[model samples]
Each structure stands twice: as structure tokens, then as C-alpha cells.
Target: MKRLIATGLALAALAVPARAEEIKELNFGFISTESSANLAKSFEPLIKDMEKAIGIPVKPFFVGDYAGVIEGMRFKKVDIAWYGNKSAMEAVDRAGGEVFVKTAKPDGSSGYYSLIVTHVDRNDINDLKDVLDCAKGYNFGNGDPNSTSGFLVPSYYVFALNNVDPTKCYKRVVASNHEGNLLAVANKQIDFATNNTENVSRLQATRPAEAAKIKEVWRSPLIAGDPIVWRKDLPSDLKAKIYTFFMTYGRNGTPEEIAHAREVLAKTSDGWGPFLASSDAQLIPVRQLELFKAKVKAENDDKLSADEKAAKVKEINAKLADLDDQQKKLPSM
Candidate 1:
């Protein structure tokens, strides 16, 4: 519903955390990006940290790709993961993964934007509207379609505004990493692409040599950020430990650990610092985004033939209306 992409056989909570359980092993999942190194190193300290904080034998399962990791969660494979907002929503909805925390940088902000970028000197294309106009002549570059800022929300952004099919209208479309896609456009290989605001800015701030060759023409309004999640069935003691660990720990003392944490998380790129605790209410934006998307889809479905549109609209409007009402009914507090 929020951040997850696949379906699951629904399950509910096992129990609340009364006391930390004996952790024999802990499996974790993350996207395969250079930014994961921090969690790879500093995150292990958490196993040790938890073992000391509580009394248990702990391990960390570092898996690649958020989708597979989330899938594993349904069966209790991953103890924790950093899922983008959309992925998080789906995990909580399907597998009973609860949103435990959100990330932030050393700075105070909570989220980042998406950028529509082209090659460094492509003066001809400056905004999303322009990209749609050039869809017939230029190739579009995308990352893994499941990527958060990289693909999921950004793809929805494009689909929201236009009717063109990415596969057919563009000269070609290349799904590559944000860095790779940016490099492709800079090298004049691809015409346009999307990346994170934090990522684009970081490139300019930390690696100006490479950043100069890139130009951003279109950017998205801020969407809610990613979340750290756990299965609802996880024992409360373990859930509390997981949540507390993220909320309290900082890359302190261990400069090596801190540096590794920085590398793994790449907060500069994501516009979040280290992980911090968040409540379910923080996820309201994601649900709102779903509603926005449903609205757009409903509008587009209206363009179909009268009979087909009528049937689809009736079904679509029912679901969208339900979601919208859910948002409104949320407690005012």
C-alpha cells in the first residue's frame, strides 16, 4: 500500500515486546546501492549493541533489493529493512510489517524531491512537459522500476501528467541506476532521466566535477520519505528493541563505524539522516499519495470507450472513494 510492491498471505501480530527475546539470527534487506555499506558495517555493531543492551545472541541478514527483502518478511526472513514509502505501505498492508521509524540526515528535514534531468547541454528540454513533447524523438532513462525515488514515485509522476506510453513513445528507455542514468544523459547516451533531489544536489556539492555535466529540468514536489519496518507478528520485545535501536543510536565514538554508517545510508543522497523513530501517522502522506494516484487513474480511465470506461470507472471510483474516506476518518490528534 505504501512502499511494498508484491502481495502476501495476510497475517497479524504475534505479540507485544515484553522483554527482548534470544536473538539467534537477524536477517535484514536493503536495496543494492553503494549507500548500503554503512549498514553493512555500522549496522552490525547494532547486533553487538543489542546483545549488550538486551541479553541475546544477535545476527544481521543483509539482503539486496527491497522487494525480495519485503517478500522475505512475510515468511519472517528479514527482521528489518529500509523500505521506501511506497514499499513500506505494501509491506504493512500485506505482510503485517509495521512502520517503526523514518530516516533523517544530520540536518532536520524529513524528505527529498525527485528530479527530471537531461544531459548537461540539452537546452531544448527543461521540464516534464518538454519531455512529453520529445517523447517521440528522445529516449528516456529510468532505474529499476521498483526503486523509490529512482523509479516508483517518479514513474507515477510521469504517468500522472500524461498519456504517452514510455515503452513506445520514447526513442528508447533505459532502466539504469541513478548515477548510471545520470552519467548516460551526461555522456549524451540518453535524453532524460529521474533521480533524487538529495542525490542530484549531493553530486553537485560533493562531486562537482561530475555534477557540472548534469542539468535538472523538472523536479517533483516533496513526497513523504522511506521508513524502517518490522513484521507485526514479531515479539513485542524484539520490536521494541528494533525501534529503540534506530531511534537512539548515532554513529558516535566509533569514527570508523560512523564513516561506514554514512557510506551505507548515503543520507546526503536520500535527504534523511540516520534512522529515527516515527509513528504510523507519519505514513499519512503515503496513503494520500495513493489517493492522488487513484484520482489520476480514474480521470484517465474516463478517456476510454464509454462502455469500458463506465465499468472501470464504477470499480475504480469505489476503491478510490474508500481510500479517501479512510484518510478523512483518521483521528484528528
Candidate 2:
């Protein structure tokens, strides 16, 4: 009888699944586009506000680059993150993350362009071609490898398409964050660098003196807005709170309330309007860019015969077409 009772108790315990630990605090990670300390300071107000709204401690994790944040997510060290389109795609694939919201421009646009920039005072570097030629005699700055505007757009539209590698074409080539690259150009520390309209607008609004020093030499087609991604497996209640806080943060509030939310959001996104509901499908443009880049590489592969290259390019194009169809079916904001 004693053995039977013990066995029954054990069976009951086994039948009742262990409860999952509730997330008490969130580690929010973002790439350091500026000094990490400065970035942290900039986000502190917003973090505190988020903590208050969600009733949990919100910790900021500012990493050196986009990869650092992605890896942090992969290891489950980061609970949520801000990501560019490519990095957001990476997080979804590697870190079990999904986009829940995106930053909106003050003008309500959901996208901005990558730009090549030069010193405003330089007559010799008046155009994209001139900026490319400047590389022969001066240092050049690119954005970090994970930067969409800083690296990918320029690589595809400016360098690879033109059959020129900046490393080989320039006296020296270096990579840094967009803020760093822009500052280098503004300070005349680098003869040329890549920036984006969003960052440029931010600089203009916050640091007009620095903004005055640079001019856009060329621009790429609009890229998707930055995304706020969170672990897909986060508790449903917590997720709901996060979504509600973001979607309601700056809109349809009392004047003071709306102003406060806008101020906090501006500090975070360099003058973004507000947060809008978003989803994983927002990353389709990035995937399409990846596909286009692959197609370009396959078409230009020297080892492949003309027929082989043509076939490879055709395959990539077909994939891109399929991607477009998928994108077309996704809900738009």
C-alpha cells in the first residue's frame, strides 16, 4: 500500500508539466553605431520608459557591431534587438526572432536610401565617378560588413557593377559604423564614405555643423526600415505588452504624452516618427537584394562557361521571381 501510494504521487507529478520560468527582465541588444557608451546613454531614457510600461527591468546591451547583437540573440543572451533588414533576416534564421515593429520616418515613409557621401566643400569630388576616382589618392571608408547602406548597396550598385574593388582601387580602405564613416567624411578624415539618408537626416537635425560638411554623391533605391525583433518564443503575455507599448507609444495620446513618446523614439532612431506594427515579411526586400547580388556574381563568374553562367543566372532570377510573389501576398502597413 505504501509503495502504491508513492508510485501514484510520482505519476501525478510527472503528468503535471513543469512551468516555464517567466521572463523578469529583458536584455535588449543593439549595434553600436557610435561609441557604445554614447549609444547606451542615448537609449537610457527609452529603456526606462519601456521598463515602466512593461513592468520589468529593461537592460540595454550595446555590442560592437550587428554580428555581436545577432550572436547575443543566438546564445539567448539578448531577449530583443534592433536590426537592419539583413541582420534582422539573420536573427530570424539563427536566433529564433521575429520582427514585431519598425521605425517610421517623420514623413511617414517606411524606407530610406543608402548614399555615397563626400565633403561639401570639395569641387573635385562632385559626383559618384569623381568620388570613385578620389579613391586613387586618398583613404576611403565603408560601413561595417553587416551594414546595408554602408556596404551591400554600395558594393552592388557602385563597385561590383562597375568592376572595381575599393580595396584595390583605393590607397586604403577601412570599414566602420555609419556614424563613424559619416564623421570621418565630415571631418575630412576619409576622402569618401558610405552613409544613408536616415543617418544623414539625424545628423542634420542633431549635429548640423557636422551635417553641413558632407554632401550626397549618389543614392541607392529605398531600403526597408529598421526592425524591432524579439524572441518568437517569448511568453505570449509579455509579447502582448511589448506590442501594445510600441504600437501605442507615440500615437493618439494626450499632447504631453505624445510629445514624451516622440522624444524618446527620436533619441533611439535619430528622429524616427513612431513605431508601426511589422512582421518577418518586412525582410523580403533584403532577401531579394541577396538574390540579386548572387545573380550578379554568378553572371560574372570567370570559371563558368557562357552557357553555364547564363543557366546559373536564370536560376537565381527564378528564385527572385518566386520571392517577389511571396512578398506580394504579405500584408502591407
Candidate 3:
């Protein structure tokens, strides 16, 4: 009887499954929206705070492009990350990622705008139309392919809606981050470039002289604030810890501690305050925008057969309708 009891206990233990490996550390991947040095300086305080709150070592991962961060999360090398909506969508779709929270502006607003900026001294280029006049032979600096405000917004509103392909419309086209594009235009390194209000405001605060050199020619409609994502498979306890840390970091603490946390967050990006609880549903509008862009492209493709164009547009419309339904089901933010 004793032997049988021991055998049953062993079988039960096996059926229960071995415990998951403990998480010793977390690697937070940061997208290259600015120089590595600047990003490091801006985020160090937050990283340290996160380490203390989570009781684990936290490391910052920097890469040259947005896709690097997405790939990092996909491979489980990056446990968490900050991502713009478009890239966050990519991560959610392809990187085993899930949105947990999003940054909120200091003013309590939840969105920012995309911008087209040119040198203040350039009188010739005054609007989207001026920039789109391909005959003028202007050089352009676009944003990272994965950037929401930088690439996707302007690509849809400024280019696609006008039936212009940026690659063929400009004398030269260069792709870089928001800061890079802003500086390029300011210095006349490029005639115009894509940027966002957040980066512009950041520059104004950090480098007023540089900020004064560029002026906006176009501004897109407001886009949702950036989201913080984590690998979906992270241990539930670890996810809870991280969620608590972000939700409370700046909202609860000693007076001075809260002040310090707010200050650190303000310096990071777009002068944000405490994070707000969010989910992958925040990406619905962005997904709709993507589909709309695809629909427009299909409509404009002269090479497509009439039947092919109809089929493409039909497929895109179906996807957009599904997304609209999903958005309707979500509670109003």
C-alpha cells in the first residue's frame, strides 16, 4: 500500500507539469526614434525605477530600426517594449506581443499629430501641394517604415490620397527617424521630411535653436498615443508586477517621488505622465487606416485588371468592416 501511494503521488506530480523557469531578468527593447545616447539618457531613470519595483535586473535593448524591436519581442529576447501604434500592431500580429498600457500626455490628452516639416527659410515650399509638385525636384526625408506618425500617416494622407508615390515623386528620398528627419530639414540636408508633433515638442524643449529652424507645412489628424507591449507568454506573475509598476509609477508615491517620476517620464517622449491601462484594441483604428491605404493603392494601380482591382478592393473592404465591428464592441475610451 505504501509503494502504491508513492507511485500515485509521483504520477500526479508528473501530470501537474514542471514549473516554468524563473525569470531572472527582463530586456526592454527601445525603438530607434532618436539617437541611442539620447534615448538612453531619457529612459535611464524609468528603467532603474522599473528594476526596483519588479525585483529583477532590467536591461535596455537598442536597435537601429523599429523592426529590430519587433523581432526582439518575437524571438523572446525582449520581454517588453515601447512601440508606436503601427509597430505595436506589427508586434501584436507577428511578435507574440500584447499591449498592456499606453502613455498619456501631461495635459491629459491621449493623441498626437503627424507633421510635414520644412526649413523656416524656405519660402518656396509652403504646403503639401508645394512638396508634392514633383517637377520642383525636391529632396525628401521619410520616417522609419514602421513609424505611425512618421511614415504611415503621411504616406496615406499626403501621398496615397493624392495618388503620388513618394519614391517616384521626389528628386531624392531618404528614410530615417523623427529626429533625423527634423534635423535634416532644418539644416537643408533635405527639402522636407516627415515628423510628428511629439518629436517637434521634444526638440523645442531640448534644443530650441534647432526647433526654430523648421516649420510645419502639413499636420495629420490626431493619432493614438504610443503603447507599451510585452511578450504574451511572460509568466502571469511577472506581467502583473510590470502592469502594476507602470500603472502606479507616477500616480502614487510620496510627493517628491511622484514629482520625480513625472519629470523622468516627461523627458522620455512627448512629455507623457503616468501610463493608462490599455489593450490591443487600441490598434483598431490604425488597422483600419492600413486597410484604407491598401484600398486606395488598389484603386490607383493602373496595371491591375478590372476584375483584380475589384477583388482587391472587396477584400480590403471586408477587413475594414470587421475592424469597424471590433471597434464598436470596445467601450469608449
Candidate 4:
């Protein structure tokens, strides 16, 4: 069975390659995050430029959510792609993907904040605990389950504070990407949700009418933003193509490249620009988030032996506690 699965994946990886010399099809996976079809349309020029630089035909595969897209990467269905930091870490851990690019603020920082939010009219909800307590019977929405802030830190930390199980404590829960989750809360379809301040600020700046309906009541500690990543097993030459393509594609970009880049970042008000060099360290927080989730899952599994649970639980708790301290140690600024 494992061998059959392996062969199936080997075939999927070839869905797209930069060159027929080493690959045929190049499938780039994305989700409803910033690069969803809504923006990918404007990016046709950009993708076309990328294809020219890399010398291959590239097709992007849109999956509705991050986990699905990341899973596709693991199964070799998606080739090159973007990932929220948490999902990126999981891909690298399980499927050997590596972070090759990241968005940069003018200051060269990769940080973005998570805002725990509720409808502006919902005054009774003052904070995360307030929502979890007063709205237990209400469905709470989550962005990508693998999102660093959207679902990871917010789910673990908020539930830890409220002493509740997100899976069982809430009357209902729905998963979507940043835009969908925010819209759900804004439209009063769910109790609350967490989104990056960067995204919210973008919407507010570009589409205030829609942003006006949402209010942030709680904010998370700093976290790294989403990243561009590719499977490490890809040929070294392919990595060079991807790396060089992004790094230099717009070096002396024609007005068209600059305009297209701006179009892709259209929603961000902070003026987030394109890729900059990023290291694996930028992903440690996300990996820690994955560990936190694994711990929670292990605690709830009934089939595991007590000894097994004990061992996993100990490791999980230690990492989470350490991460909490690590977060607190960062300067608030």
C-alpha cells in the first residue's frame, strides 16, 4: 500500500516542471489566502513572466484551504506554492518542502499580527474569553487550520485561557481562509474569528465598507507571515530557477512587472512588497504551533496507551510552555 502511494505521488510531482529536461508540468498550489483566484487573475502577467524566466509552462492549482493545498504538496499533487507559516512548516516536516521566498514590509520584517475579533455591534464581547464564554452556543469561525494566527495560536491560546475544547466547546465551527472567515464574522454567521492585522488593515484601506463591520477585541503576540515554498526533493537546478526567478524577476522590472506586483499585493494597505530572503528560523513559531496542536490531539485520543499518551503529552506541554515564554520575551513593539 505504501509503495503504491509512493508511486502515485511520484507521478503527481511531474505535473509541472520548469523544463522538459527535468520536468514537464509545474503545478503551483495556493488557497483562498491572498493569492486565491480573485488575485491570480491579475497575476497572469506575473505567471507568464515567471514561466519565461524559468523556461517552463507553469499552472497554478487552487485548493480552497491551506491544509488541503499543503496536503496536496505532501501527496505531490501541488508542486511549487505558498503556505501560511504553520502549513509551510508541516510540509517541510513531512514532505521536505523548503521556504524560498517571503513577503517583506518596507522594513524587511516578516511579522504579522493576529486579531481575535467580533462584530462591531457585539459589545458584550470584550475579548477572546468573553466571546468563548458568552458565545459557547455560537459557532466560531477559523481561518486555515494550519494558519499561524488564524487557527493555530488563537485556537490553542484562546481555548487554553477559556479552558475549553474548540472542537467540542463551541456549538459549531467552520474553517475557511482569511477573507472567508472575516466575512463570516462580519456577516454575523459566526461568533468570532482571528485574522492577521495586515489582512484586516488591507481590507479597511481598500474596502472600508466591508472592514467597518468587524472589530478586533484581542490580538496575539507577533508571528511570522506566510511564505513561498517548494519541495526540497526538486532538482537543484529547479530550485535555482525558482529562487533566481523570484529574486531577480523584478530587479529592473519593467513598469509592467512593478504594476503587476502591486496588483498582486492590492489588498495590503501596509504596502507589503514582494519576496525577500527568508530562513527556516522564520518558521519555528509555526512549527511550535503544530506541536501544540499535536499535543491537544494526543490528549483526546482514546486508543493510545497510557504510556504513549504520557510521553507525547509531556513533550507537547513542554514545547508549548516554552513557546509561550518565548513569545512573551519579545518586545511589544
TM-scores of all candidate predictions against the true structure:
0.76, 0.88, 0.93, 0.76
What is the alpha-carbon lDDT of model 3 when measured against the actual structure? 0.88
Comparing 2 and 4 on lDDT, the stronger one: 2
Candidate 4 lDDT over 1-333, as tens digits, reads: 334334334543553354445676678877556546554664556677778888989897886677777788888887787677878887888866777677666444667888887789987788766867744486878777677778778877777544577777778878777777778888899878778887787667656887999998988887775687887667656666677666654343789976765554543333566567564556767767677667777887789999999999998888888877876776542
Per-residue alpha-carbon lDDT of candidate 2 for residues 1-333, written as tens digits (9 for 90 to 100):
334334433433443344477888999998767777767877888889889999999999988888999999999999999888888889999988888788887667788889999889878777778866733586889888877788878888888777777887889899899888889999999888888997888788768999999898899988888889988777666776777677777774699988998877777657777776677888888888788777777777899999999899889888899988998888655
State the number of backbone clashes in model 4: 4
Worst 10 residues of 1 by lDDT: 2-11
lDDT leader: 3
Give Cα distance to truth, residue 280, candidate 2, Å: 1.4
In candidate 1 the C-alpha lDDT for residue 93 amounts to 78
The lDDT values for all models are: 0.64, 0.81, 0.88, 0.71
Summarize candidate 1's per-residue lDDT along 1-333 as a digit string, tens digits.
212101111111234534455556666656543345544554554456556544555555555455676677777887676677777776777767887677776654677777788877888887777888843488888776556677666666775657656776777788875666776777888888878776676566656777788888877778666677776767665665565455545544377766655554553343345665464566666666665666566567646787776676677677667767877887662
Of 1 and 3, the candidate ahead on TM-score is 3
Q: Mind giving the per-residue lDDT tens digits that candidate 3 earns over 1-333?
A: 334334433433443344487999999999899998998888888999999999999999999999999999999999999999999999999999988788898776688899999999999999888988999888999999999998999989999899999889888999999999988887889999999999999999888999999999999998988999988777766776787788778777799998988898888765888787778999988998899899999999999999999999999999998998898889876
Candidate with maximal TM-score: 3
Report the alpha-carbon TM-score of model 4 versus the true structure: 0.76
Clashes of each: 27, 0, 0, 4
Global local distance difference test of model 1:
0.64
